[model samples]
Target: MNILIVHAHPEAQSFTTALKSTAQQSFEQQGHQVEISDLYMMKFNPVASQDDFTELNQPEYFNYALEQRNALKQNHLAADIEIEIEKVKRADLVIFTFPLYWTSVPAILKGWIDRVFVSGLFYGGKRFYNHGGMAGKKAMLCFTLGGRDYMFGENSIHGPIEQYLSPIQRGTLAYAGFEVLPPFIAYHVPYISQKDRQDILVDFEKYLKHLDELQPLKFPVLENFDEKMQPLN
Candidate 1:
């Protein structure tokens, strides 16, 4: 399988970067093709603006999604966006590697999504969830966090980690039609010892080797909803 690993971390020696490297090596050793987009190294622009398009559908009003659709149709997307979009299209699987920032993705990664997951292309109208443009593809998140596992849960201080991830996991990935896999999180990474971190890398390699065995996370099925997207009984 062709895999694209989008890595978003500023520090080269960070644990998150190690995880990204481990994923690439593990996948390649397993006979899969791999590509890495190191956002910080590439100096990826994290802002979505008129600069994203060579031309606009409506120059009078700056509606980002509308312009995205126009750009996709006109082949007018900025070169960087087109490059990332092609990467996404060619991959069978896309892994997002990042250090959790404020319970969310880094700004650069978020911008990558905004620009790459173009409107009218990735999704539009009801072409989402099970019926999104990326239906046959798959996506997974491999992120590192400073929080310990015990610090998150229904009864924990930080509440459920899933809640913090729903926007990206369900809203963005699942909503775009990719079969979203359960995330592999490296928790308390900063506080962990080098041995523990190495062990985590070993565990991660094992996880990558069994990608076929991972079940996708459940989300709203279009079949279960009425024409208006209201749930049907």
Candidate 2:
């Protein structure tokens, strides 16, 4: 399988980077292709604006979605976005590796989503959820957190980790039609011992090796909702 690892950590020696490397090595050992989009290393522009398009449908006023659709049709999307899109398109699976910041993804990763998951290309209208443009692909998140595992449960201070990741898992990945997998999280990496960190890496490699056998997270199918997007009940 072709895998794309979109890495968002700033430091090369960070634990998050090690997770990415582990994934790559594991996949390669299994005879699968791997590609990395090191966002910070590439200095990827996270800000989405009119500059992303070569020719605007309405040059006077800039509407990002409208321009994206226009640019996609004209094959005039920005070089970086186009390149990223191709990477996603060619991949059978896409893994996002990053550090959890403020219960969300980093700004650069968020911006990468904004720019690369373009309208008319990734999703639009009723083409979301199970019917999304990227329906056949798979996506997973591998992230490190500052908080311990117990701090993020239902009765814990941070609520549930699922809640924190719902936006990316359901709204973004699922909406785009990728079969979402359970995330591999490393909690309190900064405070953890080297042995614990190594154990996490070992676990991550095992996860990659068995990715195909893992059951994807269940999501509401488009058929469950009406034209108004209300549950059919």
**Candidate lDDT values, in order:** 0.92, 0.92
Q: Write the per-residue lDDT of candidate 1 for residues 73-157, one digit (tens) a residue.
A: 8899999999999999999999999999999999999989988899887888767889888999999999999999999999999
| Model 1 Cα RMSD, 1 decimal | 3.3
Candidate 2 residue 60 C-alpha distance from true site, Å: 1.9
- The deviation in Å at residue 163 for candidate 2 is 0.5
List TM-scores for all candidates, in order.
0.95, 0.95
Residue pairs with backbone overlap in model 2: none
Estimate candidate 1's alpha-carbon lDDT, on a 0 to 1 scale: 0.92
Q: Report model 1's TM-score to 2 decimal places.
A: 0.95
Give me the displacement of residue 225 in model 2, in angstroms. Answer: 7.7
